[model samples]
Target chain A: MKFTILINEGPYQHQAADSAYQFAKAALEKGHEIFRVFFYNDAVNNATRLAIPPQDDRNITVQWAELAEQNNLDMVVCIAAAQRRGMLDDDERDRQGKDASNIHPAFRISGLGQLVEGGIQSDRLITFGD
Target chain B: MAMLHIVNKSVFERGTLDSCLKSSLSGSSILFIEDAVVSAVNNTAVSDKIKAELSSKNFYVLTPDLNARGFTDADLIEGIKGVDYAGFVDLVADNSNVQSWL
Candidate 1:
């Protein structure tokens, strides 16, 4: 089955991101297709490359990036939510005339329509949030 | 292709319930869990809206959540059904998709 996972909380602050990561990994391992992992609300923080966690703790952002790289996963961060939280890609940074862009290369910033589209296109739309 | 919309926040505490109700499709089913069970009670400020929505939507409150919050089936608003965890799972299986409104 094709599944779309929606994460609505930032990493570390909530267990939603971890639960979503585990579910996505298990789905892929079970041979199920993950259509997309749409990040919204505080979840856009997951795509920011600026976070630096201690050596002892798991870095969820890096984990997501590696998972996306290995599986060719579509990791999308909602542009509106990203903008609200100051998460920006190169294009957005240039458009907004910002000095830097913190978004990781593995994740792309897109509109909320992608989330609606994912809901329509995928077999299951599983949301993990606060 | 109906959707099962799960709300886990209280209506009085947050706009989550309102947003879920506003965004829901006509035939969608709404299951109130956790703190959202507070909205399923009778004679609340949002009871009128819930009753009105019942004309085109199916409303359910998680029985466990309701009980945990000290509410009974009799306290539920008219047309709202109390469902168990199995019923919640069944609702998810029955719907084409599940949207959790946080």
Candidate 2:
């Protein structure tokens, strides 16, 4: 099976991101393919590289980055959402003349078309939010 | 086609569960996670609403979330099965699509 994940809430503050990550990992471990992980709404915050969680707490951003690297996952952050929430990649930072880019390298900024494509191409589009 | 309708809000706190149940087809599955697990508890104010839908929709609750909220299987309404994180993955795989009520 191929699954596309849609996350709508940020890390730590909500369980949506954590649940989505756990679901994705479980699916991959079961030999299912993760077609993509699309971050929308406050979920775009999950792509920020500046979050420094407590030492004993799980670093949600790092967890996502490691997972993406290990599984070669396609993690997308909606450009519209990212911009609204002040999340910036290198290109966006340069284009907008921002001083810094905070988006984690594991995620790419894209349009909503990526989300649509995931829904169309994947066997199941599972959303974790709120 | 059978779909999975995931509700993650408390019934007392939000009307998301009601909306999800209203929109879900008869054969679809409804899985309660996070704060929504409270809806799966037996003898609650909204338990009747959930019970009424059991004949038409399959009900499920995430065990971890339930436990975290101080609930156990014994407290869950009859006919609502419990699933862990891995079981959540299985539900997604088993269903044709997922509609999360946020």
Specify the highest-DockQ model's number.
2
Q: For candidate 1, write residues B1-102 as lDDT tens digits.
A: 699999978899999988998999899999987678999999988899899999899999988779978989899998999987556656765788788987
- Candidate 2: TM-score? 0.95
lDDT of 1 by residue, A1-130 (tens): 7888899989998767876787687677767788999999999999988899999999999999999999999999999999988999999999999999999999999999999999899888888889
Instruction: Give the candidate number with the greatest lDDT.
Output: 2
Task: Give lDDT tens digits, candidate 2, residues B16-95.
Answer: 99899889899999999999999899998888988999999999999989999999988999999999888999998888
Q: Once superposed on the true structure, which residue ranges of model 1 sit more than 4 Å away at CA?
A: B1-96, B99-101
Report the number of the highest-TM-score candidate.
2
DockQ of 1: 0.21
**Chain A TM-score of prediction number 1:** 0.98
Chain A only: list TM-scores of all candidates.
0.98, 0.99
Give Cα-based local distance difference scores for all models: 0.88, 0.93
